[model samples]
Target: MASSTPQSVERALAMFDAVADAPGPVGAKELARRVGCSLSTAYHLLGALTARGHLTRTAQGYVPGPRVPALHRGYQRHLGVGAGVGELLVRLRRATGAQAYYTVYRGGLITVVDSTAPVSDTAEPFVPGPEIRAHATAHGKALLAGLPRPVRRRYLDEHGMARFTDRTITAADRFEAELARVRGQGFAVSVGEADPAYTCLAVALPGPRGDGSVHALSVSLATAEFRGRRGAIRGAVARAAAELVPEG
Candidate 1:
């Protein structure tokens, strides 16, 4: 957000984001540190969140509350996601033994609405509104590849290709070439480019009948694990995506 945003509102939102990005339940002390707020401010903000049903206190720490899923389900419904999509994502995770992500391109940005457990230290957080460039994550790139040239150019213009690693494609011409390969290969891939420890593969899924939303299926694993079984992982994601096309 910009400087005009209220300081308390910014801190509270940042605290919530820290909780969402956390691997497990987080304590108020850690939340304060992450958001650069004082301990008392953290407690007050956490209490507000708990009272509003945005967070739940647990034996270990605080985690997402029931309101989070309710909001998420409503978002998915607006995206035209049908039943069994969550089950399909779980199955993809079981079959591939990697983190599975379900994403949709909405409001000219790619957003991950659901994801499975992480297997390692590799975290390629692609959720928009956090200053993350679309080019830094495989799912974003895959969705971008589905966009028309003029639209893609406008997106890149609005959000510059901020590099996360040396391997990331920052140049306009190079990224265009990369999108060509994604089209030819029928999938998009990131190898130690977004995050040095993670490798991701994604396949775009056609939107539902009469719906023009951009969607994709993705799996992320440690770079070392992706060494030899890349094809198998790709197939797993492809099969999952195929399962959705017929229902749409």
Candidate 2:
């Protein structure tokens, strides 16, 4: 059985998501309605978040705080242009003619650290969400499969596999089997799993200083286009990962 999520943490995260999705600063009453909590509870949580610098209050209402930008800067510093991953992403994009992304698994979250793609008028750029769907994305699966077995099991128990598309692996046993395959293959591929229109291929990057953390490189393209050149795309991605991340 999956462990229950703490209500307070759930509520706080819901409120934060509401604030992030809003076009402008949100007042307490509106936030309460969005989070399905009482106005007082919303106010209390908002106050706490604001004090902790997760949010900022203004004449309009509450907006994301300075801490948000500071955190982003810190994340970039952790994986900066000097890290050579940026240039690797550019090369991957050129090699595959698809959007190339560098993703890292940190604090139990899969974050897209950088991406490179063509400047096309027709193609919409891929925007990664704040909460990664680990069971669906190729990079997410590659990263998850790299974790220690116990830690990976704990993560799946805490965050139950939520299905995003019909192709998403929802059964725990089946997902475990998929991770095992990824470990054996040294790469991962997803076909219309996260989004029906896109296919993604990814390979795990070397862990930082041999720590157990997970990082990966991925390329995403339209399903039909990916099908026509799957082998070439996979080879390019694997070669890039191998060249950029040194052997431990």
Residues 1-248, candidate 2: write the lDDT tens digits: 75388876788888887887677898888888887889888888898899989889888888988788777666666643236777888898999999998777766666777778543433533454443577798988898898887888887787778888899999988988998999898889989888889999999877663434577889999999999999899999989988764332
The number of clashing residue pairs in each candidate reads: 0, 0
Off by over 4 Å in 1: 1-51, 56-64, 118-133, 208-212, 246-248
C-alpha lDDT score of every prediction, in listed order: 0.81, 0.80
The sequence of per-residue lDDT tens digits that candidate 1 reaches over residues 1-248 is 35887888998888888887788999999999988989999999999998999899998999988798788778778877777887998999999998898877766666787777643534445432232556867787888898888888988898889888888889999999999989899999988778888888998887544555578889888889998899899989998998886233
Q: Local error of candidate 2 at 50, Å?
A: 12
Candidate 2: list runs displaced more than 4 Å: 1-70, 79-82, 117-129, 208-211, 246-248
Q: What is candidate 2's local distance difference test score?
A: 0.80
- lDDT value, residue 245 of candidate 2: 49
Top-lDDT structure, candidate number: 1
